[model samples]
Target: MKKKRPSLQDVANQVGVTKMTISRYLRDTSQVSTALRSKIAIALDKLGYIPNRAPEILSNATSKAIGVLLPSLTNQVFAEVLRGIESVTDSHGYQTMLAHYGYSSEREEFRLASLLSYNIDGLILSERLHTERTLKMIEVAGIPVVEIMDSSSPCIDLAVGFNNHDAAYQITKEILKSGHSKPVYLGARHDERTIIRLQGYEQAMREFGLEPRNICTDRPSSYSLGCELLKEALRRYPDTDSIFCTNDDIAIGAAFECQRQKLRIPNDMAIAGFHGHDIGQSMEPKLTSVLTPREEIGKVAAQRLLARLRGETVTPKILDLGFTLLYGDSI
Candidate 1:
């Protein structure tokens, strides 16, 4: 037979305390004397007792937990966002439950349903668009939710992000102003953000009386993909004077390929990337890119959620932290 799981009563019995005392101690350490607290702590460790939170959640009590959903786990951008969120959640004694949905609205709906079952106090979502069922679940749960990374979309409750379209448009205008008229947009993943960035690029190109050119792929963004896209761009649009990549991963990769082909930066071709990563700055001809306030967005999103949870009024349902253009040698 399988060994039985330890219970609160087992812990109480081992610590020579009533179950109510154990429950009080679990709820708040201040309720128990220091000596008893130490005994209970040791008993909990020894018996491997896990306090079931289902009872507390079923009673409509706060779970003291926040659910965070990300589209990608390997992306460093989300990693930085997670770091910023944890910095705030950790100090406030709240736990974070993370789920990855791989940029699928359907997968996001599934992951969110699982998280809601835990009765989390609030939610932090990476994407603005959600499935209808996901929206219904959030409405019924009636919990605070903050969507990050794009402010242009209609949010369920609150949003924290910079304007993606404007950021791309501004950068594209800068490229044109610098005399790179025939710039091509290199996009990957074809995600919502990527498509928005492409649209921004197209808008700028059209405004300048130049046709927009795009060399895109459905594959996830990577350094190798960047190299391949650059080769294909040169082959297809041989007269292309500049390359504007969706993100630094592709930009840096294209830069390396340029070097391999004996092309001079900005002379033979100008390149710009989005999401100012440290690696971009470290490149020989530092990459000119749009610097997103990713960490700040995460920190502010967590702050807003926590504020709402505390019954504090959070003004401006949509918060645009904004973006900056990093003027480096690559552009």
Candidate 2:
């Protein structure tokens, strides 16, 4: 009889490394060093073993990886967020795993537990208070946790994000100063971040004695869909002069719709966004938004996790990296 195929376990047996490290090499995650990669390559060649690429990593041996849970990947903003998370995770020799929750709390809860089943080293969560069960799970996940973009909640482990309440308050206040009272909020979900941003907008509008207009939180994939939503908003609330998207991607889409309507940006209708991105800047009128320290967040989150892995003390003081407001033509 012919010899059987060598498994990841067989390779691990030969290489003196974890099966998870072998999977990291197979996935091309850049978490392993060249020496280990070469060793794995030699093992594969010698044993004629192939990696299984089905249904993600199957066990905790494979799950010792770094898991990044997010709303979606189509958005460039999220891509940057991933870059930030990966940049640090890579530097520390941890493989990166990914899961998309589709901006749903229940979905996040499911994926969170699924990723945890793998016994990942740490987790980077995009939204907070997504679901009741997710909160419960976080309370006992027993690993390093980092919440990005919205850090209002009492995160169990680590947090590297902005004060959405303050960011929304400041941006809304600027819009009020520029003479626009009826600004609709565009967002993907009504999670903790969205609630805070909406609250801040309401707080500012009330401070200026302006009744907050209709809060239409429409979630869409592309420009055409956003255009339709904005068109309806324009018809329903014609006095609405400015638009504030929860993130820069939505703002860019809203701007496209504004362009299609033949509206001069910042003149006929001013537009602003949050999470300043290069895509936002590449537009005709550079997006006036908040530049969340993405790279810094990633680097810092990684450092924090590494410190914990190294048994160092981390506190809330240094973890508070704030946000900066960027003003532009659409102000």
Candidate 3:
């Protein structure tokens, strides 16, 4: 009732050759004569044969793949970063397998362990924090690994990203310089990057002799969270002159909420966001924010890992790409 799946032996039989010869031809075309190779190719096409790599992978003990772990799949920030990684990997004829841990270290551990079981050649991780078992697994794997998006001390191999603290501090100081002294910091997600940015904001506020007010939540950042954070900030710090958000999602949401409340942007409450998302610029008043080099960090991290894989030396393992302060009407 059903057609049988073609096997390597079927292709070999079709070409009047032994399975071993066909196997050698599949592994390396040079091993077979040109005429025989053409015959094998024709037979494979005729049989609709597919070469399975599982056996080869088992024998070679290398998957010829890169495992990439990201915190969020829907975020454009990570999409851009993935693009940068693929730009390098695709050229090198390497395949990338992606997994999302949803910003959870425990889930990240499980996903990473599963990837390692596949014997991937390398790994690119967006999150810095890892469980002890995750750390041990990586150490045992002893492959080229890279940590992207945020720099951390005692990294596995390479750390590539901008300094979140400095970026937040510089941007906050700019808002203060713009005459918004009573600014509050709003954040969500409570990721390592969020905490670092909050620290920077707090440091800037203290340095300016102003008390820092932070209204934050552990929930993942979103447009709705932005609106809610602003509402809470307004409720508690009624005299808040400005708000520095952890990311553009919240900042843009705050802008929309301000419009609904008939609050004049900047004149009524200055707002700034980080990550420099395109939507932030589309707002009526535009968003003032910090633009971190997310894609560039991904590209550099990939290049570094590839270099190590190729037996090339990688100098200065930790790379600080830095960030830009986008001056706009919101601040």
Candidate 4:
């Protein structure tokens, strides 16, 4: 037989106090004397007693926890966002429950259902699109929700992000202005954001009286994928003068490929990437790219969710933090 877990009564017995006193102390220490509070704390620690929060959640209907959903855990972008969100949640005595959905709507729905079952007070989602069932679940939960990373789409409740389309458009326009007329749009993952960036590139190319050339894949974005996309771009568009990548991973990959082929940066091929990753900045010919406010978006999203939870009205509902263009020597 397994040893039994310590309970409230066990702690009360160890502290020589009534079980009700122990329960009251656990709930609120203000009602209990300081001496007794110290004693109870000691006893609880000694017994290794763990309080079950299920009952408390059922009683109060608030778990003091926030649920955050991301498409990828290994992505450094999401990691920065998580750091920003936790900075706010940790200080406010709120716990964060994280879930990864692998960029799949069905998986997101499944993960969201599991999170909702825990009675989380609020939710922060990285993706704007959701399954119908997922939408229904959120409606029923009636909790504050924040959709992040893209302000172009309509949100369910609240949103905090920059415009992906405009950022891509601006970057592409810059590349064109620099006299790289035969620029190729290189993309991987084929996700919503990737597609939006493509649209921006196409718009810029059209405005310049040039046709958009693209080499894309549904494969997840990676440095290796970038190399592959670069090879394909060069094969199809031999005259490709510049490469505007969907993200830094691809941009860096393409840059490395150019170096391997003994191609000179900006002379043989000009390369640009989105998201000003540290590695991209550290490259020999630093990558020219769009620097999105990822961490700030996360911090602001958490703040808005918390404000809503605190019964404070969040104005405008949609927040556009904007982006910056990093003019590295690559482009």
Q: Estimate each model's TM-score.
A: 0.94, 0.79, 0.91, 0.95
- Model 1 reaches what TM-score against the true structure? 0.94
Error of 2 at 75 (Å): 2.2
Best by TM-score: 4
Measured on C-alpha atoms, candidate 3 has an lDDT of 0.89
Candidate 1 residue 190 C-alpha distance from true site, Å: 1.7
| Top candidate by lDDT | 1
- Candidate 3 on 1-331: residue-level lDDT in tens? 8767798899888999999999999878999999999999999988888777788678866677899999999888999999999999889877898999999999999999999888899999987789999999999999898998775455778889888888999999999999999999998888888999999999999999999999989998889888999999999999988999999999988988898888898999999999998888887788898998878887888889889999998878888887899988998
Ranking the candidates on lDDT from highest down gives 1, 4, 3, 2
Please say which candidate is ahead in lDDT: 1 or 4.
Answer: 1
lDDT of 2 by residue, 107-166 (tens): 899999998777777788877565777777766767777777655667656787778898
Clash count, predicted structure 4:
0
For 291-315, candidate 1 gives per-residue lDDT tens digits of 9998998899999999999999998
lDDT (C-alpha) at residue 93 in model 1: 83
Write model 4 residue lDDT over 1-331, tens digit each, in one string.
9778999889989989899999999878988999998999899889998888999788866898999999999899999999999999999988999999988999999999999989999999998878999999999999999999998889999999999999999999989998889999998777889899999999999999999999988888899888899989989988999999999999998888998989899988999999899999999899999999889988999999999999999988889999999999987
Assess candidate 3 and give its TM-score to the true structure.
0.91
Model 3, position 109: C-alpha lDDT score? 96
Q: Which residue pairs in candidate 4 have backbone atoms (N, alpha carbon, C) closer than 3 angstroms, thus clashing?
A: none
Stretches of model 4 off by over 4 angstroms after superposition: 1-3
Please give the ranking of all candidate structures by TM-score, highest first, separated by commas.
4, 1, 3, 2
